[model samples]
Target: MSVSTPMLVTFVVYILGMVLIGFIAWRSTKSFDDYILGGRSLGSVVTALSAGASDMSGWLLMGLPGAIFLSGISESWIAIGLIIGAWLNWRIVAGRLRVQTEHHDNALTLPDFFSSRFEDNSKLLRVISAVVILIFFTIYCASGVVAGARLFESTFGMDYQTALWAGAAATILYTLVGGFLAVSWTDTVQASLMIFALILTPIIVIVAVGGLDDSLAVIRAKSLENLDMLKGLNFVAVISLLGWGLGYFGQPHILARFMAADSHHTIRSARRIGMIWMILCLGGAVAVGFFGIAYFENHPDQAAGVSQNGERIFIELARILFNPWIAGILLSAILAAVMSTLSCQLLVCSSALTEDLYKGFLRKNASQKELVWVGRLMVLVIALIAIALAANPENRVLGLVSYAWAGFGAAFGPVVLFGVCWKRMTRNGALAGMVIGALTVLLWKDYGYAELYEIIPGFAFASIAIVVFSLLGRGPSEAAQQRFAAAEAQYQSK
Candidate 1:
């Protein structure tokens, strides 16, 4: 596809608008909390949309569509798993984390929460959790940068490295100025645009292909017999795909929303709003890919080898179904998905540096002003590091993302679950679990066997290590254990 001047104009204007929002948000910052969690006062709609937008990211725009194009109906289960898992995370983690962040930890970041909860004043827990957060978050943020660059490379004929720098800079600059406030407000707006684009683009494609009857006939004539959504996929693949669902309970970026929300009262409303938005958007992505299949089917020469270029399905559909102006708007929606996620990831990475590392360790006496500056600086440094790592630009976007996702899921997922639910969870248990989970992710990759279940193995070992280590290390001294018993009682009452 030729470089459409209209599309270029749309992208530049959208990028500029985000930059303006970032600086606008920058005006409100007075302390680290304002920089990190928007002063811990996010409302229901902003919290819900930003969290969902950040959570879904490039995966929703490109990965989901690719999956539908590649595996047909079985891909839908992945969406189901995510929906259920997200709802549960909001139900279980959101409300409590908000209250506990103040009462138990005074925690602004995940590592702070861990250190405070266990009376980890020794700084061992803080240091370890900070290290864990940084290592995995680095890779996680790289995946987002990769996705952003890929979006430009795939859609607008931009060079990968140029796109990488542009994309990373775009997210980093806003997050630097706006911090969490910019991220949340921009994410809410971007998330809405994402859903609208997903819904509208596909509907247009379906219509352009001449309705359901014509579309199906075209698809049947062109696609593989197995492309049928129902009879097309095998049970194991379906299960594996849907198993992507189990990942939500542990993701840090998603969990951050819960920790930041102003009240538990917001959670119920957030859940309803979040789920409805997710369902519609995810459904739209699938429709775009499947309908793209039909649209191309009707025009055989035009449809050529879209599966291999699966990432372009959404872009191709925009060009085929709408005039340049509408297509430019839809294209901006894809960029929104890319930018929303990249900004959120960058902010989380910055928080780990400011709240978790700088104040917690390096400069123990750093002022709020210093911490915020450090956080902003870390954003550029980290984005540059990730861009350097992602220089290869040679992997499937979903696969690379899953590897990072699995690492975090294994490393933090079980420890968090056991920590929140099981009071016997000793500090030693948390350490053992983190080590085991992190190591297992590396080991699994070394063995090249993630085809089995990327996060499952690491999560299993982490859970076992936590139990074994906690039992082996002597239950907290009697007094400490008694104090924990109160925590347990508090847990039971809740």
Candidate 2:
């Protein structure tokens, strides 16, 4: 199918509008601090929406709905797991990390925070953590690129290679120009678009199938098993699905939002707003896929695109059910999803390289102007690497996302949780947990151990390692203990 004039116009307008915002944000980005983290100036609303939008990525709209359309309601366990995980992260980690990061010499990045928190003069912690971030985030960014290419390919009938570069260009440009401020500001808009599409598309899908009752009837006629959430799921399978929640704790993009908030007090309001947005969006995504079964069953002739790739269910439904103009807006939400997350991931990777590696080792006294430019350069370098990885055109968005998600979750989750809550946690404990957690994920994923999600073992072993190593080692130094006490006191006051 060829792109309609309405869709082409809408796409052009949306892309241009985002670039405009980037230029606006560029005016405010004066230093490396603003470029990497908006100078820690985000309020509750931007904090809430940016975190939610970046966390959902293209997986929320495409990969997730496709899983349900392919496997039935059983796939929603991942959604359930995510909701639990997100809430816990906000409640347990958000304010504390915000306070702690500031208290620890006003650290600018996660590795910076960890090294300062541990007083690691050796900078070993910084190097190791930064490497893990670069490794997993490169793969994560590739997933975003693949998602954007898929959208352009499906909608415009463009060849995969052309779509790959074309799709990624807008996001890379805005992120390179505007940096964190641009990404956060655009994320607010993109999050609004994503929720609007997810909510509206499912409602229209339900009505198109004659109503909720009739839709369920059609689905029942097609396959009674589709209604059973546990139809084919075993104990291990269920645990694996639920384990997705663990990944939330360690995701750098999401954590960056927390670190950027204007005040810890804002986290309470942000949590409320963020959770409501998350639950509604997730419910709508599940509805689209589940109700999509009935719609496709009723209209088999229009099912070819979805039949070829179940991930295209939301895209096909939007085009077929809505007016051309409205459909264009709805489809743009997918672009919004892809760009919102990709831009953030690119920035985070750039930060890891510029702040953790280059500034830490090679140029400790680099000027802020030089650092900001270096960060922009790093964005382009990482984007090019991600584009190359996405060149294959065979990668599944969810598959790539899941691997990176688990890598971050296992490697960093235990360390972050322990570091924040337990001042007794020595630097060796963090190092042990980080290494053990990351290694477990890599080894388990490679060996196909127990058919379990790698995060479960990775998190469990990492947590255990932290406790054992910390206990066996000498206590934290007096200065490290004093810094932890001050941060803890501030958090308690909040």
Candidate 3:
């Protein structure tokens, strides 16, 4: 559908509005706390919405919807796995981390948390964490870039390379100015926009399909198992996809919110808000995708002629169900999801370089000003590298993202979980966790079940490394043990 001038104006307005909110976030940021974690005082709303937004983003808008559109009901299992995983992640990780990170040497980065928690010397854990963050995040960030490219290609008819650059630019600009505070606050707003668009799209699509009965009939007629949540997909794929939640335990960008939180106690409220937002937004994205399949099945002529590309379901629904203004808003919501995640990943990457490597190793006495500049410069470098790598015609976004997610899960997930809960977590165990976990996933090579039993193998090895290595080896020195005791969760101020 060639949109008229009015629709074009609507699109421009939404873009301007998003840029405006990003600027607002940048102006308010001051300290590294603000830059990194929104001052650890993010209210319940911002905390919940921002976390949900950062987590969902392109995955929901493009990935989840595409899954449903292509596979039918089988795709819903991914959602079920995600919902259970996310709820557990927040319930289990958020509160403890909020208290534990601060108690353990004021960790602002994941590397900081790991090194301080395990009482490791020579900054091995820091080095490991930084490498993982840089490597996997580059791939994860590319996924967002791909989504941006999708938007430009579908709606504005831009060339793929131009679209990729545009996506990177939008994310870089916002993150460069506001940092994490800007990313989180703007995430709150973007999350709201995403939720709204998700709601509007499915509702309109269902209506256009003559309501639920008709929509269901259309889906049923096609015999697409992609719509049913509990059917069609194999057990391993379901486990592999849902296992993404395991990565949350180790994700610095997600956990940074916990550290920046004012109090661990506050997370109880954050949990309630974050879970509800995730479920509703995710549910709607699924519906939009499934409903689009039904709508398009009945009117194939109206489609944008890219059925295999399930990601287009939402955008095509917008052009079909709504006028230009509403379509613009919905499109912006998708961009918001993409940009929110890209900004967070870029910021976290910068922090790993600035805190974990630069100041930790080279410039222990560096001023906050110098540290911040280093961070900003690293962001540019990282973005440029990701852009160059992602621009290659063959770079696979969703697959690469899963490996990064799996790397974090297998590499750090078990270590972080055990490090927090178990007092005797030894340095050898921490090293083992980092090494075994990362290598298992890398070696598994993402081939299939034989490749580490499809995600479980890597996670299992990671868990084993900590337990077996710590138990079998001698414990740390008296000084190191005392350090761990001092930083244990009990040491945090109430």
Candidate 4:
């Protein structure tokens, strides 16, 4: 397919707009704190949308729709699981984490929060948690890079290698320049673009397919099994799909939003806004894939790209069904999804390196100016590594995302949950849970045992380890307990 001139113009304009936002944010970033956490000043709307956009990533538009297109309604279980998980996260973790991180010395990053929460004078918790974040988030960032490369390759008729760097350049530049503020501000815009594209595209697809009944009839004609939610799925398989929800607790990028909110009082509103946005976007994504079966079935000639890669369903639908200009804007949502998540993941990795490892270990007295520059440099380093990891054109976005998601969910989920809710959780117990949880995921995924999602066992094992270790060890320090009580009081009041 030749490159459409309208699309080229739209893409160029969109990229320039994001870069402009980065420069605007750069002026507002006066210190390392401002650079990393936007000075902890996000309101309900920005916090809500930024978190949603960062959480969804390109997987929502590309990977998820692709899964539904290939596997049918059974795949929607993942979305259902995610909704449940996200809602629970907003209700249970958001406000508490916001207040807890502040009470525990105003920690800016997850590792910082863990180290401070446990009063780990040795900094072992800081070091280990930072390592865990870097390891898993590198893989997570690579998934974003892969998703971006796919969009560029398909949309612009570019080859995979050239498309890879071209796709990542804008996101890297903005993140490097403006840091967290840039990422969060752009996320708000990107979230709006994403929701619009998602909602509108599916409506058009449904209409083009001649209605819901007709779409279902066409899908049934293609494969009656595709209509069954439990078609070829065993009980374990269904559970595995739903287990995706468990990942929210430990996602560094999404959790960062909660920690950045202006106050705990805003979280309730943010939660409501975020959940509504998430549900609508997810519903639209699922609809595109399900109805796409009918659309492509009725028009096989236009489906060569989708046949080659079901992940292209959303992209192909946008291009074929809308005017070139509108399709370009719609397709930009894919880029939006890719950039929103990638930028934040890059920033999180940067924070782990700059705050947790560099400043925590090497330069405890590093100046704000120096630290901000170091953080920017780390973003460049991680982005290059992720791009290299994403060099393979054959990598599936969903496959890569799931592996990394499970890693974080298993490793940090139980620890974070226990840390905020259980003041009795000792540093040793936290360490034990973190290490055992991470190791469980790595081993479980490697062995491919039980045909179950690795997170299920990893989360369970981690939770049990935390309890046993905490019970066996001495309790938290007096300071730690006092801090927990203070944060809990604030959370309750809110």
Give the count of colliding residue pairs in each prediction: 0, 0, 10, 0
lDDT of 2 by residue, 93-136 (tens): 99999999999989889999999998888999999999999988
lDDT of each: 0.77, 0.93, 0.78, 0.92
Ranking by lDDT: 2, 4, 3, 1
Q: Per-residue alpha-carbon lDDT of model 4 for 1-494, expressed as tens digits?
A: 44588898999999999999999999999999999999999999999999999988888898899999998988899999999999999999999999999998899999999988988889999989898888778888888887788788877779999999999999999999999999999999999999999999988998999998898899999998888999888999999989989999999999999999999999999999999999999999999999999999999989998999998899899889999999999999999998999999999999999999999989999999999999999999999998888898565643655578888998899999999999999988899999988888888866757599999999999999999999998898887898899899989983
Question: How do the residues 22-55 of candidate 1 rate in per-residue lDDT, one tens digit apiece?
Answer: 9999998888889988888898999899888988
What does the lDDT come to for candidate 3?
0.78
TM-score of 2: 0.98
Which pairs clash inside model 2?
none
For candidate 1, what is the lDDT? Answer: 0.77
Between candidates 2 and 4, name the one with more favorable TM-score: 2
Best by TM-score: 2
Best by lDDT: 2
